[model samples]
Target: MKQLTFLLLVLLLPSCSVEDDSAPLFIEPIYVNNPTFKLKLDIIYVLPNEKYAKSKYNIDESKYLDYLNGCFFNRHDIGIVLGESRTLVNPELYDLKDDRGNESAIFERETKGTCKPDRLNMYIIPRTNTIAIAGLGVTQRTLITDEFLFKTTSPHEIGHSLGLHHLDVDGNIMSRVKPYLRKEFNSEQVSELIQQIITINNR
Candidate 1:
């Protein structure tokens, strides 16, 4: 009877171990050197109405910034510092649509009152009328929905704001697909991104 009990316990242990191993563990990268260039970032959260609640939409800002810093500082000696943040309760701007260049029209309206030329302007929305686009970046401005805040989409749009173009490679930061695998910017992109920052700082 004692031997049978021991055997049953051993069988259960393997199943428990299997369950533990089922989930993949993600280890974040470590950085020892501080970045030389730091860009100022400003965020604006748009709510549909005054009564609408603001949740993270399953993605927190700290985690997104952590991932952004890890990729930029670790590779290119670039980092972002939060400068200003605000919440805009505008129903018209919140319901953004991409119909017939309305995205640009709505973006202009959203930033008209709060535009800061010195810092990177990031607007967070609940969702876009278009489902295919996760975000859009033009020059110094960026618009990202809540659901993609913590994904590689954040960095990808920032790359565009810094003048980096899209790449077909699976692992490049500017890739159009494979968000999980996209990690680092290529050497040319690094140089261009740094140059853009320098130009902006000099201005």
Candidate 2:
């Protein structure tokens, strides 16, 4: 009887061990394939007229697009074609006090009148001093930036559009502070962005 009991216990232990080993561990999904999506650039100017504002900035849209392609999209295998290019003149957006006013609120108000549902909207503004911002995965995805913006600013804002948040580490595209020179996205960020792009495409 004792020997039979010991044999039964031994048999149960192996099954219990196997069950423990088979339990699922919660792990995030990682994507290895490159995902592509459409991106639009909307150069917004708060001035008397669009032509006057263009002269003030003197920005070459095509050249800027090419630079962005090299720095971000092409490197990540994310194909971003130039979409709608428009100039907006909003006194309210321009008049809003930078230090006292809210950038997000200003963006929301301006984009509500001009946002397109199909593509990412990048709003480039020329100002002496203003805050730059980006909407994270919102339907009215928008980026509000100034003429003096760093080269990495656009890509960083676009990363936010793809649902990426700021990282505390330096030399990362998603760093919280400025002087962001790093243009590379980490694997996890890429995977998460890919997932977001997939969901957006599916919809």
Candidate 3:
């Protein structure tokens, strides 16, 4: 009887460690061998009339780019190239034609074409390659967070550019909101997105 009780306790030990369903998931890191994917950003900022170039974040665009690159590179081993003088289709592009036919009016405004198996998405806005951080109403101060070098909003878009979708798992770069990313994509998502990118690019 004593031995049976001990065995029962041991069996219940793992269950005791089960966390609450509402608790956030703490994910492990995924270290990739430098991204094999070569990415380009034809960024545009139509927010409040093409203000990405003049926004406070743009004071150091390269710094922002580095942060963006690091977030993705650590995930699927991807590199980013900022395209010059490219005309972005603008968020309004979809209103003109909903080829992909996404129901998200907000997403349509925020994202462009996801070409490779829908992995590589183009952000069309403002006409110059950039993402602008703007606030609606009194939410101006809400964007400050450790998840990004500057603002979390830009990285969200960059995550899509790197083939990451908004996974509810906390800490992953593609999380819908903050902490926007626990910093980078974990091993599972990295593999999933890489295969998606490869599938998309090979097409």
Candidate 4:
């Protein structure tokens, strides 16, 4: 009986070791070696009329493009290129109250007659009701506040438009904390974004 009990314990130990080995030890941030996809963007800056504001937000378009490339294209071979861009004046839409269950109506009004299926529709607005919620991305449209125009917010929201979800990883592009540290996407997310780009291109 003692010999049989010892043998059973040894058998169970091997099974447990197998389970541990099956678990993944690490997740790669980039799986694609050569990516040839570049998403196009139609950026629209919505500003208030002269009565409210006279100049556009202080944004450096070149720097913004560099950020996008550094965060996604340089690392994973996928990036975004600016296509058509314009500015509009509408005080109400400029000061966007995007949250509080008012997102759909507000977004629709702001994007009316300007939404394109092939290009990502990005609206640069004055701000939302709260500073914490800086942007919104649904389908292929992304709305960004002027305050976060030059931060990692665009790529973060664009990730959502590409079907990626928020991650708890601090240094991940999809994370909600430490905006400066958020730059990389996990391998799974890279794979998903690649698929999404293919689907969008085919559509």
Candidate 5:
């Protein structure tokens, strides 16, 4: 009887060890090596009129582009080329109200007839000095961002354009809360993004 009891305990220990090994030990941030694909991003500043041309909330196009390029390089070894920039006067887009949920209508209004299919369009609008929605990604590879948001918001929105969604976990590039605090993508996210880029290039 004593021998049988010892055998049963040894069998249970292996099962318990197997269960423990099932869980992952770590989830390291993902990074790509020698990325082959590159994306051209066009930054568009949407001003209400000439009066607000020197508004403090307006983003410096060159500086913002440099910031985005550095951020992407550090994360996934991806390259983002700074494309053309233009200031458009559209009062309707500047003073648009967000009555509808998701703010898709405002994004549509701001990007309609202004986007190019070959490049990504980033529109910085003077909706408010405060960061309301931070950024909105629309079809045609266009993004409408708030003027007062930080440069980190650019990559966050760009991530959305690449088909990545917000993650529930903190300290991730795709987290919904204070994404500016995190700037790195996990291993899985980087892999998915690379695959997405490959698919787009093939198409």
Candidate 6:
């Protein structure tokens, strides 16, 4: 009886839903004939700074841009891009605290490489003097890989800095939750991103 009941629950759960690959991504159709947004996104990549100097990852100085470009340009088509070797590209930083009553780092990496003015809501860090990718929890460039982890991670972190949050809290590349798992946004993600780009660029 328990076996049958378990089987039924699994079948009925939302997790059992089928992926609708054929469905067009649900972009809000800015229909911009000419649209504008109050925010501007600046894309930045990780540098081999003290932050990454301590990690097990190693970023390939050569191949870094390939994935970064693919992730952002392929998705949104608009946003300012900063080189990985550069220091905090955007000069905005803020301080914050955590649940343990201990003050936490906030502004350093929360913005990855983008700044949204008043809407900086996703992955925020508080320690560093510059807004960076720390919220991605990948501080060192050495800990990165040419493929997989580091490649996707770089862009994902930058996205958070732009104002994106966890689509899936667990390891989802787009998640804002801690102990993160690098999850990539699906086909649907591209649409949401494009909407913003068109709105921004068309402005």
Decide which is better by TM-score, 3 or 6.
3
Which ten-residue region of model 6 has the weakest summed lDDT? 11-20
Per residue, candidate 5 scores C-alpha lDDT tens digits across 53-112 of: 535355666666556655554356666667677666776666544432435566676577
Q: How accurate is candidate 4 locally (lDDT)?
A: 0.62
lDDT of 6 by residue, 68-145 (tens): 444434343433333223223222232222222221233334443443332312222222322222333222111111
What does the lDDT read for residue 84 in candidate 4?
78
Worst 10-residue lDDT window for candidate 2 reads 12-21
Candidate 2 colliding pairs: none
CA lDDT, every model vs. true structure: 0.64, 0.51, 0.38, 0.62, 0.54, 0.33
Q: Over 4 Å off in model 1, which ranges?
A: 1-27, 50-59, 97-101, 128-130
- How close is every model to the real structure, measured as TM-score? 0.73, 0.67, 0.46, 0.70, 0.66, 0.37
How far is each candidate from the true structure, as Cα RMSD in Å? 15.1, 16.3, 12.5, 13.0, 13.4, 12.6
Give the count of colliding residue pairs in each prediction. 0, 0, 7, 0, 2, 24
Q: 114-202, model 2: which lDDT tens digit per residue?
A: 86555666666554334323221234354544543335656656677667766534455665433334546677677776676666656
Q: What lDDT tens digits, residue by residue, belong to model 4 across residues 33-110?
A: 444887777777776675533245666776676666764655777867787777767666665543444654566676
- Which ten residues in a row are the worst by lDDT in model 1? 10-19
The CA lDDT at 19 in model 3 is 14
Worst 10 residues of 3 by lDDT: 10-19
Report how far residue 10 has shifted in candidate 2, in Å. 48
Tens digits of per-residue lDDT for model 3, 50-165: 54343522435466556556544645576555554232334443232242232233443344342223223333332122222221101000111122334444444444444444
Candidate 5 at 170: error in angstroms? 1.4
